[model samples]
Target: AEECINSKIHEIKTLEQVIGKLITRYNVLEENKLKSLVNIYEKMKPKDAARTLNELEMPTLLAVVKHMKDSRTAPIMAEMDSIKAKALTVELVTRNRLPFATAGSGEGDG
Candidate 1:
């Protein structure tokens, strides 16, 4: 029983390390994909980019905006549909705001 337990524990540890490496690899791949997309957007003219961007769903659009440089993003936003641009900006700001707001609230709990 003791040896079996030890073996199981070792197996669990090995599985955890494998899971950690997989997560790291996944994150790197996602970052690279985001960078590649940002490059594609940056290379397009603002109006063309806006038209392409308009077809993307909101979450995908927000993810692109998050990774994109502000200088490049600004021109695209200017060319985008005003209503869509405003909504995207609001969603981006909300994503950033949640963490800070939650952290600030937690500090006073002590």
Candidate 2:
């Protein structure tokens, strides 16, 4: 019985190790997929990209935008629907993660 228990423990340990590796592989693939999406967005015009991006879940959209250059992302933001653009801008501001200044209400008027 003791030997059987030891064997079971070993099997459990092996399974745990395999699970850990699988989780790591899954995460890597997900990261790569996000990177590929970012690359595709970077290649598209801001207006076109914004239209397509509107269909993405907010977290996924944020992840892609987070990887983009601020200059590039700004144009995309400008092209996006105002409500969505405002929501994303607010989220970024609240997280203290935005890299560039958002245009304020009439702040630029001379």
Which regions of candidate 2 fall more than 4 Å away from where they truly are?
95-110
Most lDDT-accurate candidate: 1
Tens-digit lDDT track of model 1 for 6-98: 999999999999999999999999989999998999999999999999889999999898888899999999999999999998888788785
Clashes of 1: 0
Q: Lowest-lDDT window of 10 residues in candidate 2?
A: 97-106
Q: Taking the tens digit of each residue's C-alpha lDDT, what string does model 2 give over 1-110?
A: 99999999999999999999999999999999988889999889999999988777778788999888888898998999998898888777666643344444445733
TM-score of each: 0.87, 0.78
- Candidate 1's TM-score reads 0.87
How far in Å is the alpha carbon of 35 misplaced in model 2? 0.3
Stretches of candidate 1 exceeding 4 Å from the true structure: 98-110
